[model samples]
Target: MITDRHYEIIVYGATPGGIGAAVAAARRGRRTLLLEPSPYIGGMMTSGLGRTDIDWLDASGAIYREFAHRVEAHYTAQYGTASPEAEACNRGMFFEPSVARAILEDMLAAESRLTLVRRSELLSAEAVDGRLTAIAIETEAGEGEWQGRSALSADVFIDGTYEGDLAAMAGVPYEVGRESRDEWNEEYAGVLYMNFGPSKEVLPGSTGEGDDRIQAYNYRLCLTDVPENRVAPGKPASYNREEYASLSVDAAEGRVRSIRDVLNILPVPGGKTDTNNHHYCMCSSDLPEENGTYLEGGREERQRVRDRHRHYYQGLLWFLQHDESLPEAFREDAQRWGYAADEFADTDNFPPQLYVREGRRILGEYRFTENDARLAPGLGRSPIHADSVAVGAYAIDSHATRKREAAGRNVALEGFLGLGWLTEVYQIPYGVMVPLGVDGLLVPVAVSATHMGLGTIRMEPCWMQLGYAAGVAADLAIAGGAAPRDIPIDNLQDELLAADQLIGFYRDIDASGLMGKAIQYFGAKGAFRSYEARPDEPLTVERASALLALARLLPGGSRFPALPAAGAVLPAGADMGPRLPREEPSPAAYWQRHPLLTQGLAGRWLQAAGRALSAGTAGAAGGSVSASAAARASSPAAAWLRTDSAAAAEGGPSASGGAGEAAPAVSVGEWCALLYGLLLEARRAGSSGSGGR
Candidate 1:
């Protein structure tokens, strides 16, 4: 029976961002309705792309880290950490697709405030006076489309679907294709391809102004070479020998060698590989002129497109492995690989979700353009943002927008664009998550960004981060009885900071452990007033000194005394503790920039602070700190720091010679823990030695 339902928060789609939004909102005491079209929850992670594409770990925020830790625990519990399975899982960096799905399912089931409905799709949405009021959903009843439909009213809504269906139904403006270069002043925008390159030659319509050309979509296949756990590729229902005519020609001419050569086979847990298309159209899986149509079409149409892709790709796989028309060597090499036995058993070893590379992007209030992604002349970093809700470090990565043939050469266009590695992490503004002139709705997955800009922000981590932020924003708005856009940004930042969300990288604190409070404390004292440290980027001497001064300053007191009058430097051949590994190299060149905080200097300063505090001259511990303060700086939270410090003190790189390693830069979190931990330890020692002094 279809019935009208009311929810405080309605999250459409079970994409990672949607799951994140739903979990966050429910955890915050709001009634959340999480709807998904499929039976499974995880999108691609549960489908086949098990290896996470996370680059900037610090930028992923608290929830993501929490999820990662849980995955690690799962492995440790089941496989004893040292087992090959656990090692292959790599602590959530790689895992089985089913494992990813199971985790998401557990998360959903554990949340009491979240109501999840699988096999339900959002049909339409209603918005009045710029605020979305309610939405309609079509549920599956047995095996028929006539399943009763239902209406849902919610205070806030999130469109986390890759297709952006809810946002479209709500009448929010969106773009479906690449923008013209002049439209957003993005150099990589518009139709970009080489006129004479082997992959993308001067084909008709090869390089033209922007059109409704969406990037190619593919299923992230999980395959294994192990005969026991592998299923041989068989002929699809729509198999055609004609499809291999062109490919066979390329193979006979030596342009194509073994099928494995044109496939991206990334190793995952249990010896399985996440396979996808490589160069020269081996598994590009892109269908031109159909993607745009599917974006605008209904769920049924989208399903058809997805099915067509599966059939075509499956047929291509069968042809490569079975067809005798191809070279015997290539065919035999292809025979070694087959579908993973443990993945997607429900779909006959095929992935459930289609890897929709590009889709409807919300025309957000503040559109992120390529200019926001531009590298600083020689530096590989982009400009920073004050209103950053999340950070993304991945370069602009886009697959092929279109494929064609020109001058008897197969050509793919506008496929790959990258800045390789960034000099600094880029900030994604909060405004990008809000659709322009739309209220009570946050489009985290299909966020507002130019085609070129979306290249970096479209990753799963960025989406999940944005979705988590959206959930917080929704909760804040509900509590304040105000629109999401009307909430004071300062208050938002405060709330985000309280939850350990990465709004900005102040004092080298990326919201890891109890670092936020420490960073915020030093930030409040103007120690890091002018500095914005990059993710994992080392701190300079001046920056480190500034932070240390703040830590040493007595609360309620004004002035900071100068550094302990130039401590004696250790001369060559001096006995420096045990030998350790080389120091890690800092991101920037030391001579070109300021002096870095070496491990030796950091240890010496820590030892000096401890000595000074024990002598009763350093500073006072004030009235009281937060009850959770100790836990925040507890050893477990700061274990990595201690390990590094121990290594450094033991004639490590800072003491001995370790060339081209990372210079020991004290993180804001580490410095805070060190300062507090040392003071506490020294106080204990002082009290033990004193006889009622």
Candidate 2:
């Protein structure tokens, strides 16, 4: 029997990114459906990966930040605000798998427009004229529309699954594994062996040649020491003592002192820790070369790989706990920990999800490379994306893709790289989400990126940001009756900014504020002197006027509409000329005019504009004029109104300030911020057409 259902957006996978996409779409008032192959949600965050991969909180966009806030609130609500549970919540980034799952479930339940189908699998999909019109799904459980074969039709389909299953089924081209170093001129491309790196050292036999090998996959188990909530590891049917003979040696040699030495066990709330492979450990959960075909394989092959991982991990745990070959002290430490009884209660107390680090990445509009995330040459930041919808600061590192000789060197772990090196704040362009040839589809999870590029983009925080963007973009597409790729970037960005999502990075300021937004807005347009937007520096009122004038020209653009005669939509990678109003310079033209953001000359346009803003808002007695002191500047014209409105929003100068009393010292940052805020408010006032205010 077949069933039919219609929704504005359909997202598959129920991973963190899937949940993010579904929830954002629904919250934006679009009817949405989220399908999970498993009966669970929140993927790793709710499974075994309780630790969120985020360091700088500002880089985290709105959705992840909201999840973090709610997770903390959950603990505080259950156990008082000052309780140990609340304190251990680590601002919601630290939580048990169960807590994470429950929190996400609650979040999904609160969204009335979203319908989540559990244990659903994608059977096939249909497309016409390069547009996906519908997809077929089969749910093994539940009842009625929730069970059996069904056809789902939507305006837009977002593939949020870790494996890019939806996009693949829709016939979007994809790449798996590493690319040649020369392919994208990426330094970390292909087989890698890091000896030690203050700088990256390529070992002998290390080749930048392309290969199909990808980083290893493993389950991040949630283990607890609580007597009442502990399920001891047992011997798996596939356990072979010969496979773990090396672990015994490590324990005797002090390389493996306890379970902690082999597995990275991080403390979360509720007396449990999320455990995963330790990169430099003697032995780890990661099994290299075992997962090579999992990406392109059928359901059975994929499940076989997952089962292999389960047996390998379970056997290792049992070996650590019960094997007499290791010292009693080491065994005792391993014995203290077991799968948390309250977590993953189904499926034999084991995490049901396998953390697929790298999957089938769509060969989409733009293939992001390491260069996209690295600080370019002398610049302090990464490449500034014109259509930036999200920001990421995580290091571009991956786990072992190929293990070394069984006895050789753990340091010889091919493809193993560390964090905190060669990564700066980078912006992810919307093009990554737009798959080539597929109009109604967006692949936010398995995005278009080289293996090295996926190193950072693969993080849950970054994927969630992309997922959230795709959600908003999908709704915008529906509203305009346009394809996902044709959604106007300015509209998407405006929505992101309103929700306090980080489209651009600021070191000393908050993007949600007008000052931060203004600077980031222009920065995205390549208006900053360099890539940096140092918004806190003082500026003259003379400079501020020019920038406010400049801000006026940066307006929303029309979607690169299809040509009427040809009647063909621009393919995903087509160069959409000039992402700015006709009045503004192209990014190249602007780049040549300004170059890098220099610190000298009022700062040089954050130098030219910063100088201009500082001169206009807070200049020297002869040159600059703050809001209170601007007698010459204080005519009740639009300039005064603009500055006044900015000042009011910033809580700096009073609304009733008379002409030229005594202008306070205004920073160039403040002036830009104030002007930007006024500009934003005026823009949002929507097609009133800047009534001269």
In order, the Cα lDDT scores of the candidates are: 0.67, 0.75
- Candidate 2 lDDT, tens digit per residue, 175-195? 988898999999777877775
Model 2 stretches with alpha carbons more than 4 Å out? 195-202, 406-408, 529-532, 540-553, 556-666, 674-693
By summed lDDT, which 10 consecutive residues of candidate 1 come out lowest?
A: 684-693
Superpose all Cα atoms of candidate 1 onto the true structure and report the RMSD in Å to 1 decimal. Answer: 11.3
Please give the distance, in angstroms, between residue 78's alpha carbon in candidate 1 and its true position after superposition: 1.9
The best candidate by TM-score is 2
Candidate that would win on lDDT: 2
lDDT of 1 by residue, 270-320 (tens): 789888777455334455545666888776888899988898788878888
What TM-score does model 2 achieve against the real structure? 0.83
Error of 2 at 617 (Å): 30
